[model samples]
Target: MKLYGSLTSPYVRKARVLIHEKNMAVEFVNEDPWTEDSPVIGRNPLSKVPVLEIGVDSYMFESPLVVHYLDHVDGKSFTPRDPAGYWQSQWWQSLGQGIIDAGIARVFETRRPLDKQMPEKMQREEQRIHRAIDLAEKTIKENSEFLLGNRYGLADIVMGVAMQYTDFRYPHDWRSRAPKLNQWLKGIAARPSFVDTQPPGFEPPAA
Candidate 1:
């Protein structure tokens, strides 16, 4: 298996974390979806990051699809067998992905040349991110040791990736604002899987 994505992508981080936690072996290929003629386009027509090439025979795209496939096929199953647990994990996964999307958008917009950047749009994305973070912290406060329940499963992995991304990109003194979430993030960061999957520092691609 080959996983293709940049280290900066939170979605890619989620898939990477799951692969590590399940002890699955795969090749890591870094590719920029924005570059013309990038190989990711051939594997995933949508040109998305975290594209997984299963073999000469097949491939898959989208972090959620990769995650579900990994858990069901090549990796240990962390998703719940029960209907309620399944729904809970699904919902939390969506929530985590939403936060990642909004946060990434905000980061990318701010990176754009100041004359081209839209402050209003960036502000909206920041607000969405704040709302998502508030919800995540609230959920963690009410739930068990884990996001879904007692066991650390899919939800924790997805949300942890989002939190890490925020720290990497924003780093606006969030730790002091959300104590429970900060504590939870610290615990997750201590895990070997997360430590291994953590994103590398931002770097410009070779021209």
Candidate 2:
């Protein structure tokens, strides 16, 4: 198995962290999609990273799908079985993806030429991020340790990467506003899975 993506991508980092936690034997293929001739196009026309080559000519694109496959590989489950627990877990997963999406938008908007950048759109994305953080804090307050009641799962992984990526690509003054969320992140960051997969220049917040 092979995974192609850039190290700086939070989407790719999600898969990498899970692969580490499961000790999955998958080769990491470093491919920068920005290059003129990125190999990512060969497998994923969208030129998205975190594409998993599971078999000959068989590929899975998208971070959440790649993560779902990894989580279920080897008959192992990274989700709760009960209907309520499972759905809530899924909700958290969706919110985490949404948060990352908004963060990515903010990142690319800033990268645009100063004259072409849309300040209004950037503000909207920034607002989305802040709202997501508030929701995550509320969920953590109810869900207890981790995002699902102390049972570290895939949702937590996605959320963790999203938060870390925000810090790396879009620094914000959000930690103080959401103290519970901050505490949750501190514990998640200490995990070997998280520590080993951090992107270049990522510094964990002091606890």
Candidate 3:
């Protein structure tokens, strides 16, 4: 399997981290979705990154679906098999993905020329990010160690990558606001999967 995405993309990072955690053998193909010549458009009509090619004429887009497929193939999915637990995990994943969406929007908005940038849109995205941080703090405080109860599963992986991306792009002092979540991320950051997949020039500084 080949995963096509940029290294700095949080969505792509989520897929890459899951692949490493599952110890799956897959090729990493760096592709910029913004470019017209990108191969991602061929695989996905939406022209999104993190498109997983399983076989000839077989492809999977969307980070969650790609991760789900990988987990299904490995037979050791991080998401709970139980219905209740599955939905709970999916809820957390949605929140994490929400953060990723808002952050990416903010990044792109800021990249635009000052006159062309939309302050209102950027403000809305910032508010969304703050709301996510508050929600994450509450969730982690209530459920110590991981997002879904005590297990480190898909929810935790999704949230962890989202936090890392925010830190890289926004550079906020979120640790003070969400201490538990910060510490939780610190532990996960030590994992080989995370360390190996750290975005280029965005790795956490030495303690």
Candidate 4:
């Protein structure tokens, strides 16, 4: 399998980290769609990174779809199997994706030409990220052993990348606002999946 995407993209990181944790072998092809001549345009009609080639000339887009496919390709399921834990994982999965989406929007909004940038849109994204995280803290604390779906499952993997990327691109003192979330993040740093896939030139805060 060949995974094509930018190394710094959080969406791509989601796939990379999962493949690592599952001990799956994949050839990573760095493809930046922003370049004048890019191959991602062919793999993904939408021209998005993280397009995974699962078979000869066949591919899949959308991080969640790639994640759901890859999470089970290693002869076992990495997601929650029980009824309640299954839904917990699903909930976090949605929240995790939202965090990354808001973070990406906020950062890209700032990259726009200064005059063309919309402050209100940026502020809205910022609030969405903060609120989503706050909700995560409350949800995890309310349910014991549900830090990332009652155990380390697909939801944890996705949310871990989301938070790490948030800290990387969106600078803030979030550790204070969500102390439990901060501590949970620190614990996942030791996982080889995360250490090996750390974004280029960006080091996570010291554990």
Candidate 5:
């Protein structure tokens, strides 16, 4: 399998981390979706990064679906089989993905020509990110060691990459707002999967 995506994409990071955790041997192909000549467009109509090519014809897009497919292929599944835990994990995963969506919007908005950029849209995205973070803080505060329960699963992987991306792009003092979350991230950062897949660099938008 070949995973195609840029190092800076949080969604791509989620897929990469999951593959690493499962100890799956998959080729990593760095493809920037924004480039005019990117090959990702050929694999996915949406021209999105993190496209997983299983074979000559089989391909999967969307980080969640890619991770889900990887989990089913081999190794211990990150998804809980029990009904209650399974639903809880899915709920948290949605919230985590929400943060990524908002953050990505904000990043793109900032990258637009200064005069064309929409302050209102950027503000809305910022609010969405903050709200998601607050909910995540409360969830972790009440839940077990990880997002779904005591065991680490998909929820943790999704949220971990989301928070890291938030730090990379927004430059917020999230630790002060969510200390518990900060601690949780610290623990997960030590994992080989996360450390190996850390974002290449902090490239904040120029003023």
Candidate 6:
């Protein structure tokens, strides 16, 4: 199996975490989708990061699908096989990933030259990001440690990737404001796979 994606992408991080958690041995191919040479375009027409190719045949794109498929393939169960537990993880994953999209957009907007930046759009994204963070923090506070039930499950993994993205892109402000989440993120970061796979530096994807 092979995974192709940029290290900085939160979406990529989610797939990477699942691979590690499942102890799956797969080659990690570094590819920048923005570049015309990127093979991601061939596997997925969307040219998105975190595309997973299974063996010589099947393939899956997008972080959510990649992780979900991985959990399914492992058969050991990262997600609950039951309906309620399944839906809970699904909801948290959506909320968690929504923040990632907003964060990505916010960063892109900020990277633009001052004259080209759209203040209104940036403000909207920033608010969305904050609300997402608050919701996550509240969930963590209500649940003791993991997002779902007692053990760390799909929900934790999904939110973990999202929080990691926040640290990689936004850093100080959000981290300081959400101390408990920061602590949780620290624990997640301590995992060998996460430490090994974290995106290096702050380079932006090519236009």
Best by TM-score: 2
| Tens-digit lDDT string for candidate 3 (1-207) | 999999989999999999888888899999999987877889999999889999998999999898889878867889988899899889889998999999999999999999999999999998999989988888765427777767788888898888888888877777788878887888788889889999999958442
Worst 10 residues of 3 by lDDT: 140-149
lDDT of each: 0.81, 0.88, 0.87, 0.86, 0.86, 0.79
| lDDT, residue 30, model 4 | 89
lDDT over C-alpha atoms for residue 84 of model 4: 80
Ranking by lDDT: 2, 3, 4, 5, 1, 6
For model 2, residues 70-144, the per-residue Cα lDDT tens digits are: 888777877888898899888988888988999999989999999999999999999999999988877677425
Q: Which 10-residue window in model 1 sums to the lowest lDDT?
A: 198-207
Model 3 clashes, total count: 0
If both were scored by TM-score, which would come out higher, candidate 1 or candidate 2?
Answer: 2
Model 2 residue 64 CA deviation (Å) reads: 1.1
Across 52-161, the per-residue lDDT of candidate 6 in tens digits comes to: 99867667998888888888886787887789988988998899889899889989999999999999998898899898888777766632566677767778777877
TM-score (all chains, Cα) for each model: 0.91, 0.96, 0.94, 0.94, 0.92, 0.88
Deviating ranges (above 4 Å) for candidate 4: 142-150
lDDT by residue for model 1 over 1-207, one digit each (tens)? 988998878888888888888888888899999989987888899999989888894898999999888878853589987999999899889988988898888988998999999999989988887887777777776424677667888988998887777777776666555667777777777799887766777321111
Q: How much lDDT does candidate 6 score?
A: 0.79
Tens digits of per-residue lDDT, candidate 4, 93-173, equal 899999999999999999999999999999999999999988988876743433653467778888899999898999788
Span of 10 residues, lowest total lDDT, candidate 6: 198-207
Q: How far off is residue 154 in model 2, in Å?
A: 0.4
Runs with alpha carbons beyond 4 Å of true place in candidate 1: 142-144, 202-207
Would you give me the overall lDDT of model 1? 0.81
Writing each residue's lDDT as its tens digit, candidate 5 over 1-207 gives 999998889999999999988888899998888888878889998899789999997799998888888878785789999999989888988998999999999999999999999999999999999888887788786424677667889989998888888888887876788878877887776789988998888542221
Please list the residue runs of candidate 3 whose C-alpha ends up more than 4 Å from where it truly belongs after superposition.
205-207
